[model samples]
Target: MSADCLFCKIVAGEIPADVVHETGATLAFRDIGPKAPVHVLVIPKAHHADVAALAVTDPALAGEVLAAAAEVARKEGLLAHGYRTIFNTGGYGGQEVFHVHAHVVGGAPLGPMLSPR
Candidate 1:
């Protein structure tokens, strides 16, 4: 784990988060800043720079992250209506934290996937 990474700290219990779900390999927590009625961040217990890196280095763990996100969405009651899972890669992708995480958001119409340019 990267000592300076915020998600790593959350995983390590050094920082507090509104955790929603957890598994041997993953953790799901509510997002501090909610863009939708339900917004949770699902992450792997192990650290990776980003989703792409995680996919390349440890595909199994990456799949675990997705599974956790799906579980979070189910727990959040978003399965029937629908939900969105996002992984912001780098700065251009809007990833603030370096640790790989999946944002599971739903509970209402989220509108367009991105702002119309």
Candidate 2:
């Protein structure tokens, strides 16, 4: 675990987060800044720079992250209407935290995937 990484601290219990779900390999928590009615962040217990890094270095753990996100959606009652899972890759991708994480957002209509350019 990267000592300076925020998500790693969260995983290590050094920092506090509103965790929603957890597994042997993953942790799901509520986003501090919620963009939708439900916005949760799912991350692997292990540290990885970003989604691409995680996918390349440990695909199985990446799958566990996705599975945890799905479980969060189900428990949040978003399965009927559907939910969105996002992985912001880097600076250009709007990833503020370096640690790999999946943003599971739903509970209302998210008008567009991105702003119209």
Question: Candidate 2, which segments miss by more than 4 Å at Cα?
Answer: none
Per-residue CA lDDT of model 1 for 29-91, tens digit only, reads 999999999999999999999999999999999989988898898898999999999999999
The total number of steric clashes, by the backbone 3 Å criterion, in model 2 comes to: 0
lDDT tens digits, residues 68-109, model 2? 998999999999999899999989999999999999999999
> TM-score for each prediction?
0.98, 0.98
Residue pairs of candidate 2 with colliding backbone atoms? none
Q: Each candidate's lDDT (Cα)?
A: 0.93, 0.94
Model 2 scores a C-alpha lDDT of 0.94
Candidate 1 residues lying further than 4 Å off, grouped into runs, are: none
